[model samples]
Target: MIFAYNKAHVGDVLMILVKNDNGADVTSTRCGNVTKIALKETNEVVAWNIFQASEMLGEISGVGQVVLSDEQIALLNEELAKEGFREVITQEKNSKFVIGFVKELTPHPDSDHLNIAQVEVDNGEMLQIVAGAPNIEQGQLVVVAKVGAMMPNGLVIWDGELRGVKSSGMMCSPRELQLENAPDVRGILVLEEGSATIGEAFSPEKHWHG
Candidate 1:
């Protein structure tokens, strides 16, 4: 497995999908059967596109189960190899998140339930992020968004999605990703594990353990 950045354009999420093509009737279908996933990079495969694979092939045969296809795997490898990225064999990236620390968290002057925080991400890059969580506090090791982050729920973190407002990225909590044990509330989360130093990484790997 790989930690592909989840992207949505039109209507799809991208991942460094690992599947075996057990040779089914990948052919014989017209369109929308197989989907096209572009392996892209901005230094790495930072963004990708998804579409019906059948459409990309435009009348072909011998396409089989993407999860069990040697040919498909080879094709994917070939693409990445061309770009110098090795094949990923573990699911670590899938369940982990690298985050920055929040040096300061201040209440938003505009709203009561809202708060503005000064977060230090990437060791040096600091940002003023507006948050709305009760438990959030100063000097807390919180999750930092390094620009391009996609919530598991398919909400793109680009400029805020609030009322006529723009947000840079998100300071994620467990529930946003729908962790099984995530507290049911709208609030920021404090990491109990991992270092939240700027540019560092953390993940909800523990969330699925129980």
Candidate 2:
């Protein structure tokens, strides 16, 4: 789940992103000050727009990617109920950016440059990623941006396929992470051995600088 609020630019509204519609057509339904956006065909809710949000949830501070507390989530549910909407929002507590260990790498059968990687991100949680970084190698410690990560450029990572291969996450480059003094070149950022614990959240402030 992602929440965003910018009173000055977007008015006193709260934007809640529940899921991506994958460019599918959508329909919007409004009840009171709340608007629910859903897929037109399946009616699966994808997002919500709450007008006058500050009046109910108090003033939210931030222009993008605002973090809400558990209390705030409950309040949002209450508001949804009041508006006769059955959908409920939940808080996502896990970090989407973390360190990963590449356990295996193989050439993609359908792609010339892309390589399929079996990466161990969390304890016993392996993800198949398609990386094109020429410098990528097995046994490397690298940054992994899992599905649902919101990049610095406002791009939301989602489960995707590459060249007929299923890829669950991304091997991030310094440029993709918007790191300070990122190299003007191609290749994923490789972390030094013992630099960080596998599966731990990656903090650029502590790990990288110009």
What is the lDDT, from 0 to 100, of the residue 85 in candidate 1? 47
Model 2 pairs in collision: none
Judged by whole-model lDDT over C-alpha atoms, candidate 2 comes out at 0.89
The backbone clash count of each candidate, in order, is: 17, 0
User: After best superposition, candidate 1 residue 183: deviation in angstroms?
Assistant: 2.1
Off by over 4 Å in 1: 1-96, 161-166, 193-197, 206-210
TM-score between candidate 1 and the true structure: 0.52
lDDT of each: 0.49, 0.89
RMSD of each: 11.2, 1.6
Candidate 1 lDDT, 102-162, residue by residue in tens: 7876666567787777777664777777777778888777775534444566444444534
Model 1: per-residue Cα lDDT at residue 105: 69
